[model samples]
Target: MARPLSPKLSPSIIAQAALDAVDHDGEFTIQGIAKKLKVSPSSLYNHIDSKADVIELMRGQVMGRMDLSGVDSESADWAGSLRIIALHYRNAYALNPRLLPLVTAYSVRDATTIGMYNLMAQTLRTAGFDSTRQLEIITVIDNFVLGSALDAGAPDNVWAPGEAASPELRAALDAGLGAPDRAQKSFEFGLGLLLEGLAREAEVLG
Candidate 1:
C-alpha cells in the first residue's frame, strides 16, 4: 500500500524546498528534491503541477528579494533612481550567479516579474516618456545590464577555471584586452548614455 502524504506541506513550502535543493545541490530533479525534503515524490506533485512550476517559483523567489520601492518615480532625480535600480539588479545577480540562467530564460508573465517591468515603466513615465518609449527604454536598459553582466562573468583566457589556456589566448590576455570592472562601469555608462539620448529625443519631439 502507498504511504499517505503529509498535509503539513503547502505549495509555497514545496517550492521553497525545491529552491533549497537548487541552492545547495546546484541541480533540480524531482527525486533529488523529494529525497532532500524527506517527502514522497508524489507528495510534491500534490503541491506543484510540474518542474516548470518549480522553476517559476524559484525565479519569483529571487525576483521578490529585489527592493523596487526605493525607486521613487516622483523624485526630481529620476535618472539617479534608474541607476540605483540597475545597480540593485546587478548586485542581486552578482550574489546569486546561479540565478543568471533563470533570469535569462524566465519570461515576465509572473506577478513578480511584471512588478519589475512596471517599476521601470513607471520610472520612465516619471522621466516624461510615454508608454511606448518607456518600453523601448526599459528594453534597452535591460539588454545592456544583461550583456554587461554576462560579459563580465564569462571566463576569459587569464581567468579561465578549466584547463590552462592556449599560448595565443594567454598572449592576447597579456596584451591588456580586458576590464575587470567593466560590468559596473559599463552599466553606469550605458544608463547615463541611454538617459541622455532619451532626454534629447524628448526635447526634439516636444
Candidate 2:
C-alpha cells in the first residue's frame, strides 16, 4: 500500500514549492501544490490559511528578492532614488511576470509590505516633503510604476499580432501620431511631467 504523505514541511518550504510550481506550470492550484510538495491538501492548511494566503506569501517572497537596501534615504538625489526604485520594481516584474498579478494586488496591511512603502515615504520626507505631501508623492509614484510596468509587459501589437496596421492607424503613425514609445520615452516623459508639477507646487507653497 502507498504511504501517506508527510505533514512536516515548513511553511516557507511549502510557500517556495508553491511558487516553483506556479513558475514551472504557468498556473497554480492548491491540489497541484500539495502534490508537488508530497503533502495532503489538508496538510497545507496547517501552514497556510488559503490559496490567497499562499499567493500573498509568494508575493512577499518576490519582493524580498528586490534590493531595497540600495535605495538611499539620505541621498541628496531623492528623486533619482525614486527613479531607481521604480526601475527596480519594473525589473522585478520582468523577472517574475507570473507573479505580477499577485504583487500588484498584495495588501499593505502586512508588515513587510507596509515597511517597504514606509521606507519610500521616509526617503521622500527626508527630501523635504511634508508628511501629507510625502504620502501624495508616494501614491503618484506607485501608480506611475505599476502602470508603466503593466504597459511595458503587455504584448506588442496585441490587437493584431504580426499583421499590418490599418490604413488609418498607419496614416496616423506616418504623421507621428501613434502610441508613444512606451518602454523608455513614455516613462521618462511621465516622470519629468510629474516632477515638474511637484516642483511648481513646492514653489507655490513656499
lDDT per residue, candidate 2, 1-206, as tens digits? Answer: 98774657776677688778766776578888888778788888887887778877776666666687788887877777777777776666555566666655655544555667877887777677898888889889878876776667656553442357787876655654335554656777888788777766756654
Show pairs that collide, candidate 1.
none
Root-mean-square deviation of every model = 4.9, 4.5
Instruction: State which candidate has the highest TM-score.
Output: 2
**Where is model 2 more than 4 Å wrong at Cα?**
1-13, 16-27, 97-106, 158-182, 203-206
Single out the weakest 10-residue window by summed lDDT for candidate 1.
154-163
Estimate every model's Cα lDDT from 0 to 1: 0.70, 0.71
TM-score of each: 0.71, 0.72
Where model 1 places Cα greater than 4 Å from the true spot, the runs are 1-27, 152-182
Window of ten residues with lowest summed lDDT in model 2: 154-163
